[model samples]
Target: MSSARENNPPAKTGAARKARPLKTRTYGLFRWLHVYISMFSLLIVLFFSVTGITLNHPDWVFGNVETRQEYSGTLPEGWKTGNQVNWLKVVEHVRATHNVKGSVADDGYQSDEQQASVAFHGPGYAADVFIEMGTGKYTVNVDAQGAVAVMNDLHKGRDTSPLWKWVIDLSAGFLTLVSLTGLGLLIFLKKIRPAGLITAAAGGVLVLLLMRLAS
Candidate 1:
């Protein structure tokens, strides 16, 4: 029996067989997630990366270029007789006439003996309306920023809409998924596992050091 067992080839072990398939599945899943998620977040990553550099040095590219304009117009006659300060009518008229772009700020309206003022704020944009309560006359002053400034504002989520804020959140989630899946893929490669983990650890250390230095 001993001689027969020695002569015959060793039988394949059940555990080893199962382990191979499991490992393959894990590697496949990790690779699939890593590749697609990286691709999906590519544009989001690039946008944030470039914008990060631009944000760090605001004056480098756009040089704070802003266009200022003034416009004058007459309001509806009914607005004065019934209610001199019809907020909705005032905002709509200014937006339509001058093609204004912005959300009305909370402190947008103020009343005084002379005139009432309304302020609108948005990413790289601001528009203010001055109305004479006695007469239906109004003036609009708009300050529009350059492209670089607009991009920077978008990156910061400053004066952006709620929808855009949701987009930023989803982008952050996608990027996190991509990073975690990439790290997951390294676990299956036995040959380079140690080196890869060491490199990752070094990266973490480097970031910490940089932050320390910055502080």
Candidate 2:
């Protein structure tokens, strides 16, 4: 009986076989998630990466031409009430007359100088209005930065709308998901796991070294 058991090995047990199928299914699910999520986020990743390069080297000129326009106008006297400047009327008038597109970033009145300044900011765009509180005479200066500047601002979520901020957050979540699933898939590949982990560690160390050098 001992010789027969040694020769046959009693055929592999069901419990061990079941464990393999569960592991394989889990691995397959993670792989599927990794592939699809990566595909969906590819464009977003490319945009951010390219913008990152542009951001890091601001002096790397992309011929970003800034065009400035100056216009002189007179505002209605009713736009101001006593010592206070009516900001709402001023902004509306600027938007209607000059076709300005941006949110008001600053609105201040200098009582001594009898002047008021209103500034608007948007992605790669700025508009400033200086007004003589008494005469209502105003000067508008509008600056439009080139396309590259706009894209960079969008990537950084600088002066962007809340909707765009949401997009950045969602993209970050997707990237996190992709990374975790990718690491999970590597665990199932025994032969490559050691090399993969080493490579990942090396990448992390390189980033840390670069940050240290930068500081």
Candidate 3:
């Protein structure tokens, strides 16, 4: 008679054998994404990081913090017909005369108290116009808040255009993807994953504790 051990061979684990390759593919995908996304976001990451430091310290004066100029000019005759001021022409004249820029502020166009005020605001620039009702003459104050201020303003999205705001949102999305992929890649690193996860957890806790203490 054949030996009992020889009569029944061990059962083959075909499904389990297939699972190993699938797990490897998953790990490879994460690694690929992490590497490419990090390269792609490198510039954006650096920009935000450097600007973050400058933003945290508002008192750090760099470049001309502000430059003020006063301009006085007479509007064209067509701008004012008695008390009914042709506000459109008035605004245009100021812009054309002084090379003023930026979109008009929300409350920038107001006609009250026998005078009209028109204002424009940009990332780090401002222009305010005051026109006397009787005469078509006007005075404007322009303020330039320099390059550093402009960078800070861009970081905060104070008065950027719709396109630039979209850029900010897209950059944020890319950063999130890079971070998630990095963490995913770490999970696949069986040799270092346990220590890596513990370090990450501890770092997060430290940040939370710092925030609480700061507040």
Candidate 4:
């Protein structure tokens, strides 16, 4: 039995199998691919990541954003000083004077308050104009510039040209590919990549939480 065992090939143990050297070429290829993809998308990645951080800590990043915009425009023809106001002339006048890239449509009228309102959605923002028919004064409130708002609006292709939207969609697809390749490389080196599992689990949880919250 001893002679037969000696002649037979030794069974490979886990340690022996693990001790086998990693393929340098395969490792190099993965690293090269990762580096190239990261370099190609560096700017977009940086922008999105920074914006993410900023969004997470909004108070620190956006405490000083503008909140209101008020402009006085003289009423044009068919508009009255004290009589009931016309919304079409107001919208056209505001677009001409203040560069409002939106159409003004009738929102509603309040009988008790004797007021009329119009709504406008622009490239980066939306505004509702409320005019106190009795006072002949208008008040406009604008939202704070937020990272999520900016990112989401970009994702929705709001007011963007068709070509720009296409670019964003293509870049998003490339980002997914890069991320997947990185995860695969990580799986191959999990044993030596200290804290790799922990880091990956944490990242997965974070993504899930963020997506849930966003949805």
Candidate 5:
């Protein structure tokens, strides 16, 4: 062993021996993943960001939207099949007749003593139709959601249908992994040790506090 040590000179030093190759590799992989995904999703990120800013400050600078929609539907065989009306058919008919270029927005169901209503808000406008399942009196309300409505409206796209939306959820999950790996890397690097821990802890506490407050 001594002869071998003398001949090879023990390549790894004390500091090198303590180093974590697995951690470094994981960090590097996650960093690359984060970069590529961020690049691919840059437009989406910017879209959300712009909408967020506009949503936050509505009064200062706001834009107007003009909505014109004509809808007519002959009742399908089971119009109220499965206790839910065929809202999609109505939306599709509107789109085909009106020549809407963008996606359809599906807000939650609106129900009251007189009518059960379904609402859809899309780019530049919105449409809500109350169809009496029993009597078949159709009423449509189409309007715009200024800036705040636009952000809220974006959440309603048919894009939520799990085909492309899966990419979004997947990216979000990987972003969490990327963040964790970055934290690990920061901890592994001794120079920036306490700062990383303090920032992470403070961020976590702030997020928890905000969630609690929101709830």
Candidate 6:
């Protein structure tokens, strides 16, 4: 019986070796994904993290210097034929003359009073134009809140273009993938898994406690 058991030990060891390859392959794939995704999202992660700090402490990031510019001009006479105001022409003319940077956010016309107002919005910048319909007189006010404010707005996706919003979405997805794969890799590390999970749990609990305390 002892001789038979010793011979069977080789068979058991071979089976274990076969199982090991599958586990190793899965771990390798996860590590690969974690490394590459983290690489791709590194800059995006840094930007959002830094901007998050700046956002939380706005006074530290930006000074109180806001720039305001005012311009008065006359719109094309043909814009108001009767009671109708050609808003497209007005927008185009204003954009061309003043070098406006953003898309038109609102165009409000008070037909009863023959008054038109248009607002343009972008990251940390706004422009408002008020026009008198029949007389073609218009006033433009542009407000710019500087570069730090622009970066903060970009982080929040405020007044940003659709393409930038897509970039934010993609960055978020990649970051999620990176985090999951990193956690998966930790599971394979026998010596470190317990400590890593405990640390993660502690960090999460700390955040929850902070939130609860604030509330």
lDDT of 6: 0.85
Query: For candidate 2, lDDT tens digit of each residue in 1-215?
Result: 99998888866777766455788899999999999999999999889888888888877668578999998899876787886888888889989999998776433323435788888888889888999877889999999998778888999998778899999999999989999999999989999999999999999999999999999
What is the lDDT of every predicted structure here? 0.86, 0.86, 0.85, 0.64, 0.61, 0.85
Q: Kindly state the number of residue pairs that clash in model 2.
A: 0
Candidate 4 matches the true fold with a TM-score of 0.50
Provide the lDDT at 57 for model 2: 81
List candidate 3 stretches off by more than 4 Å. Answer: 1-20, 80-85
What lDDT is obtained when candidate 1 is compared to the true structure? 0.86
Write candidate 5's Cα lDDT for 1-215 as tens digits: 88887888857878778766886788677678757766776676666557666656656444534445556454445445655666667556545654443444444565544566766644456566677766545666666545555554453343234554664565566556656757766776788889889988999999999999999
Which regions of candidate 5 deviate over 4 angstroms? Answer: 1-24, 58-61, 64-96, 100-124, 128-141, 144-148, 155-164, 213-215
- Candidate 5 overall Cα lDDT vs. reference? 0.61
TM-score, one value per model: 0.83, 0.84, 0.84, 0.50, 0.53, 0.85
Candidate 6 lDDT tens digits, 82-184: 7777878888899999997787655433444667788888999999888887688999999999777888999999999999999899989998999899999
lDDT ranking from best candidate downward: 2, 1, 6, 3, 4, 5
**lDDT for position 198 in model 1:** 99
Give the CA lDDT, 0 to 100, for residue 196 in model 1: 99
Please count the clashing residue pairs in each candidate, in the order shown: 0, 0, 0, 0, 0, 0
Which structure among the candidates has the greatest TM-score?
Answer: 6
At residue 51, candidate 4 shows an lDDT of 57
Candidate 2 positional error at 109, Å: 7.6
- Between prediction 3 and prediction 4, the one with superior lDDT is 3
Lowest lDDT block of 10, candidate 6:
104-113
lDDT of 4 by residue, 43-100 (tens): 8767666656655664674433445566554445664444656655776766777665
- Write the residue-wise lDDT of candidate 1 on 20-94 in tens digits: 577788889999999998898899889988899999997685556889999999887555444447788777887
